[model samples]
Target chain A: MAREASVSEVLLDARGIAKSFGGVQALRDVSLTIGRGEIYGLIGPNGAGKTTFFNVLTGLYSADSGEVQFDGARLDIGLPHLVTRQGIARTFQNIRLFANMSALENVMVGRHLRSHASVIGAVLRNRATRREEADIVDRAHRLLRYVGVDARANDLARHLSYGDQRRLEIARALATEPKLLALDEPAAGMNATETASLRQLVESIRADGVTVLLIEHDVKLVMGLCDRVAVLDYGEKIAEDVPDRVQRDPKVVEAYLGGALA
Target chain B: MTTLEGKRRDPRVALAGTLLLAVALALAPFAVGAGAGIAWVRVIDFALLYIMLALGLNIVVGFAGLLDLGYIAFYAVGAYLYALLSSPHLAGAFPSLAPGLHWPIWAILPLGALVAGAFGVILGAPTLRLRGDYLAIVTLGFGEIIRIFMNNLNRPVNLTNGPQGITQIDPIGIGGVSFGRTLDVFGIGLPSVYLYYYLFLGATLLVVFVSIRLEDSRIGRAWVAIREDEIAAKACGINTRNIKLLAFAMGASFGGVAGGLFAGFQQFVSPESFTLMESVMVLCMVVLGGMGHIPGVIFGGILLTLLPEALRYGAGPVQTALFGKVLVPPESLRMLLFGLALILVMLYRPAGLWPSAIRRREFAGAGNSPENGAGSERE
Candidate 1:
């Protein structure tokens, strides 16, 4: 279903990325090329370095030796906010909404980079600042509605239902207007129905022209939803292909079963 | 929680409330007889000054969620700047160093604020990576270091006049109207204390207005987001380092303005005035009143400032009536009761005496499951 994206221009190219913590090598020479508008999936067993790679791409962790290019520009992978400014936004493995802020506020914070109101403007609240502020609110409300969580726009993020919180997180990420939106285990705690809705939402996001990079342990959903699947085993990419082929690859099967059996 | 179109109240109601508050403030200093009215007004003036300081600290501690223990350093900077610029002590010591700057109050206020804001940035830069307790410790040390500098800088140079502090500092005035003298207005004589009271009140209101504006601005939202989760805030494209520095600079500027006002009002400033206790008291005001709520913080500032003085007067009389004599020194008893009141307020109103609406909701829903009470079931 997502194969058309594979034929499009490449959007994010992370090359030979490696990261380690003390004695543990979290990632080793992992590389990926996600086409524009692709819903790419990364799956692995426990400690397989899926999240490590995600963090590196999103600027939470600086790679020991690597290079990432977004929209054909060399991405400096040191500061997370800079990574976001370069048009990549991400959600955490555990949902990390500004827990105490209202859902609307969480989305507005995502608009931080997009809006340009300085201290002087805010203090004086002149016409331009007021208009920008109003526009921010309008767009935030629209994003909340886009994610189907507008009704809970005023509720604190922590007080939202688990699935709605996930959706709200998506709304926040979307508010950044990123070319690439990365989700880390977005469906980790969702039920079947919740997962279905989340899948539809991810599709609609891709349909809206934003590329998505998904990291999940839920192989079934990934295999069904993603255009191409990459499987990691013990911090190494074991397979990369269409989902059917990646699923059939013996090394991929062995890595998953081996970890489960062990 | 403060959306641009969140809620609207009637303008008439708001105007009425403002008028009532203004009238109350205007008439408050005269409540006591003329004999004791000056002292009472002085206490209120100090309370207003403290309110400005608390509002400044709230920008850092409440809005940005930075635990600043050395915030008094900025206040000291402002005070000392005003002292050096406006007092003749510098001329007495140096004689040839331009015969004492004696800069005007208007000029000194902005200079004080700018210098204090610079100090704030200096402190904020090194502590960007620190969180909570560690940040508090560093700030506390910073506060003490500034005090120790002021206390000892008198040696070989006599910049601050050592432990004695600066004296004969010019009182704040504008356009030939000296605030240091009583003025007759509309057939009523307003004392110097009353004049200063009005000045402090105006400054306090300005600070409150600026605080409210910043509270709902883009920068304010960034601060709250950083406070909530630094990592998430970064992912949302907020430059946490710069924003944190901004919080410090903005907060410290307020302290600086308050410090200038304080120095001008008292006509003296010493290292003793900028102690660690003052910083803690300001923090307490932010917490006890309502961490991020403007009115709560103002109330907290006023309450904490006036409470000790009130206790000083009432403690001795109460002890004499109850124990047939004053058992503990009134000073000690005042602090003891003050401590007891803080503990009780913390125990009962854990959120604060008056918290922001969101904080109130959080406290109200404390024991409920995250997804239970205010949330819809999973779809």
Candidate 2:
């Protein structure tokens, strides 16, 4: 609805996306457009292809057939790192921080795609490399601050409380300076207080001029945070409209509600 | 200034300890000679050499988490480079492997490193693509191939002495000073032990420094990143395959430098010394020392080397006293005990006795590092 009602630029337009596992089609002809600086929510039942869509968009897995366009650039998403470098980043459904590394280091890794210092520079510990490294460290700290994780910078990422890790993951992704970010189940295990914080955080990311593609199961959270919503059931998009319309769509309710949500 | 920021106060303590050790080593010649004391000095040299090799292996297996079973190949290459350069045996054949080679030992040492590093790239290019178990098997095969090449391959042209190995390698001489025979230095007699012992000590320190530095760099971070979670590392823009190959090439060169020093010190190079067991022994050092840890690997290497030598002498007497005959000799019981100990360590402390702080957490419990801990939270 954000793009359909506006004349602004499209940051990411994913069309006719399809994926399969052996004989099962995990996703089928799913399509969604995320306008620049907007929060787009993708919703579905369990195994409704929400993560499959995120995986395809983030380059974790290639779609069997589809087109992913980010800033008008075609994306086969052959390599996750390449997609990340093209200014698209995402969190895993399960958190994936570098365990032994300090939280600061975890965020610094996000700055890795940005640091182009060569092997020779690193091996010799040259001045340019040192400068680059210091810059990255500073940016990493700044990013940690943005996510409210600055106090935990010295802590090993694994040692952080669950809520903090999710926040840190968002911070790490932001350090990549992405134009579009996909967050997979960021609130899956959070308490109400933490989810409230995440909602604010996502809003803040959008306020910073980056588009968001969200894979979330919490319909209430989606309805509150997203400007537009896309619904998938059994690998196909059944509804694409404002969250209110998505909630009222009979096909979506039949596919997901089974009965009224408690 | 590096990633080891937690090391400031610790390095000062280490420097003091190293100074104390250097002083004791300087005075050791007075304790005895030719007897077990001289043998003890030789034992320290071997330990230091093993420490260097183990440190390199640690970078590959511990830091990069790429299990290598044929690390001895680099050792062989370094020894051969030293032999071909410092001796006339293969000098008549491939002179580049030997070179004008009249450069100082310090100069040749780096060349040996380069040669070994080059080979590391060669092996790692194809093999680093393999996983843990497959890498181990391939490395084991590579080690055997080097040993076999060293053992055979004699031609109409004389080179390597064909199982006879290279003998009478010239020891390093600085200016006009001879390091081969004993001499006087600072009122203390400079024996062969003193010459090579200091050399080995210096090399060991260099290895430790470089390994620690490598572990913290973008390269080191890339390695640990891969080790902890490879898919994530690559997703983070690390070329995992190339990063793994870098780990291999970098790790292998340490073995080369140690091999070169060994060749110079021994004044002989034998194919037999570069055996499958030697590789296994170094692997054990990394395992025993605590993976990806500099101090642990050094201590582990020294302890492992000296324990057998100590047992050799102690075993003869203890067995004689108990059984009226030698019960288990050092060579036999040492290995049996070594094997059993690794088994026990793996079963009880799978991470190691003193693993890298990160690896300790990686193995200790469920996912402390959110990414790596994913599957571990299983029933």
Q: TM-score per candidate, in order?
A: 0.95, 0.88
How many pairs collide in each candidate, listed in order? 0, 5
Tell me the tens digit of each residue's lDDT in model 1 across B284-345: 99999998889899999999998999899888899899999999998998888899999999
- Per-residue alpha-carbon lDDT of candidate 2 for residues A53-98, written as tens digits (9 for 90 to 100): 8878877788889898888899757677888888888887888877
List chain A TM-scores, every candidate, in order: 0.96, 0.95
Summing lDDT over every window of 10 consecutive residues in candidate 1 chain A, give the lowest-scoring window. Answer: A1-10
* Worst window of 10 by summed lDDT in candidate 2 chain A: A1-10
Q: Tens-digit lDDT track for model 2 on B30-54?
A: 4535455687888888998999999
Please, what are the lDDT tens digits per residue for candidate 1 over residues A94-176? 78888878999999999999999999999999999999999999999999999999999888888899999999999999999
lDDT accuracy of residue B352 in candidate 2: 64
lDDT of each: 0.89, 0.80
Clashing pairs in 1: none
Q: Which stretches of candidate 1 lie over 4 Å from their true place?
A: A1-6, A259-262, B4-7, B32-36, B368-379
